[model samples]
Target chain A: MIKLKEALVIAEAALKMARIRQLNPMSVAVLDARGCLVAFQMEDGSSLLREDIAKAKGLSALALGMGTRALVGRAKHHPAFFVGLSALSKGNMIPVPGGVLIRSPLDAAIVGAVGVSGDLPDHDEACAIAGIEATTYSWDAGADPS
Target chain B: MIKLKEALVIAEAALKMARIRQLNPMSVAVLDARGCLVAFQMEDGSSLLREDIAKAKGLSALALGMGTRALVGRAKHHPAFFVGLSALSKGNMIPVPGGVLIRSPLDAAIVGAVGVSGDLPDHDEACAIAGIEATTYSWDAGADPS
Candidate 1:
């Protein structure tokens, strides 16, 4: 279980990194494995839909058991499947780079995930990694290890 | 227009009130008059459904142009109408307290609405009121102003 304290920590760290990197104002969402929202924050000046995008990214990571980054290629190769999945998930499956899966360092168990928005996709993904790295938990951004 | 800064302040104030009153962990959502999410936070211990409930309450108030408190009686009297409204809104019209409309003190024009969940309905409404009162803006909890 991803405790609330850790989720808050992850969210705060992500926001802090965004500031330090001079990225655009951002929205971040942390969700437990069941895709339940644990904590969320949207920075001032962020566009209205940023919150929904952030949550959708996180939900996509959880639903597919992979970071949204990995889903991007699959989505491109199988547009029909991606479209069906999006509909099935009620538009929560956003295959993008900012969604990252959180895992336990000890056994690599899925714990939770983080989604970020308001910056370039690479920058958003970087912020997510920075937040996860601030703790003992491991993260997968869905890039191939090799 | 409800600035994101004010929205964040309202959400934080509501959460602080919930803690002070020893209410259950709560989720708070702030929405602009357009019913777009501006700021939201779900306390760690809150149930998974609390965020949805919070947003729905705020949307309900905005959709009906009244606080959710005022809708309860009307909903009870016109169950079919309320049901249809809920369906039309994609299940966002929850006719209950805790959804308070935020108004500008100058002209009483609605700026936005705040919704809180995870406690007794009355307590939730109180927290929403406290949050709105913390700002210069006014609020309507849908009670008759007799």
Candidate 2:
């Protein structure tokens, strides 16, 4: 398992790459292939809760093997489903911004994911997107990490 | 900062007090005085995602300054409102079952939270309830940690 250091490096670089210096302090979490946390980091001044948000976002993306953004539309069609999952998981099935599927060049398996918070959805998503770009994973071939 | 160890102790004690001995592997998460992770424990054979789920629940409760149950009503009234939040936080908000705000004494300023996931919602809730009963804290009546 590649440690989350790679993802955190990407997340931090994305913060700078996205010019997020003026944004609210942020938090980012990375999960392993098994969906366990590989690494978690909170930027200075971030809301303490930013962490939970990040992890939930990442898990949502990972479990469904889809970007949380797309999950929103699915939830729209099946509100109860996501709602039920939200309850089942106790509320971490957010289908929103700031989550991305990570993949690797070798075999193109999804390495993990990155979830971001402490800013607007768009900005938060922007950081995550930037984070992906910082990784070695090929974003063009998006697929679930098995 | 009360380690998640204390929180885990509470969680396990809660389960024992409730007499739940492995309906499913359970995950427990505790946050600190500053709302960071005190500790996170996922029982073996639990869902691969249990630890994240558990911690994320606790994180949601503390971040929102409400119980996971309260979010259920909020989610009902404004399902659409949470969509954006899901995006912003990146999908880590559970509003039901076995999630709580870990707080200080007296005014109950939130110090942290505990999230439990594994069994039925009621059973999970029982674990969290047991944890709180066993955990103790000290705070100046009117003081806020933040």
Candidate 3:
């Protein structure tokens, strides 16, 4: 279970990384394995939709048991399935790169997921990874390092 | 318009109030007038559904143009209408006392709403009001002072 303290730590670290990178204002959401929000923060300048997008990315990762980065290609190849999935989830599944799966470091057991939005998708994913790295947990963005 | 900074202030103050009062761990959600989330936080031990309940309370206030305290009576009298409204909102509207309408101090215009959950309904409502009081804005729980 992802404790609320750990979730807040991940969210704070992600926002701090965004600031260091001088990225656009961002919103970050952390969700436990059940796709329930644990901690969420939206920067002052974030657009209204950023909150929903951030949470949706996290939900997508949790629902699919894979980082949203992997879903991008699958979504492109199977548009109907993706669309139906989004509707079924009440628009909570967004297939994008910023959603990352959190895993227990010792056994690689899935714990939760984090999602970030506002910057480019890749940059958002990087921030999410940076946030998870600050903790003892591990993160998967679903793409082998190239 | 409610800034993210203000939203966080409301959430943090609400949680702090809950702790000071020795109430149960709580979840807080702040939503702009359009019913979009601005900030949210769930205490470490909060149940998974707390986040949804908190946000739904705020959405209920925003959608009905009144604090949820007022809606409770109306809902009891008009169960079918309340039920339909909840379905129309896709389960976001929850008529209960923990939801409070936030008003701009200057003009009394509704700026947003705040919701708190995890304790007795009256205690939850009190925390929401306390959080709003910490800001320059005003709050309405839909009941006149006795």
Candidate with maximal TM-score: 3
lDDT of 3 by residue, B58-109 (tens): 8888887888888877888889998899899999777779999999988989
- What is the total number of backbone clashes in candidate 1? 0
Model 2: docking quality category: incorrect
Candidates 1 and 2 compared: the better one by DockQ is 1
Ranking by lDDT: 1, 3, 2
Backbone clash count, each prediction separately: 0, 12, 0
Candidate 2 residues A7-108, lDDT tens each? 667767757744545777777777766678877777764545677778887877787777777675567677778767776665677766677777777876
Clashing pairs in 3: none
Task: Encode model 3's per-residue lDDT on A1-146: one tens digit a residue.
Answer: 78878987898899999999999999999988877888888887677789889998988888989999998888888899999998999998887799999999999888999999999999999999999998999999886332
Model 1: runs farther than 4 Å from truth?
A144-146, B144-146
TM, every model: 0.90, 0.52, 0.91
Candidates sorted by TM-score, descending order?
3, 1, 2
Give fnat (model 2).
0.19
DockQ, per model, reads 0.50, 0.11, 0.63
> What tens digits encode model 1's per-residue C-alpha lDDT throughout B1-146?
88867987898899899999999998888888878777777887677699899999999999989999998888888899999998999999998899999999999999999999999989999999999988999999997332
Give every collision pair in model 1.
Answer: none
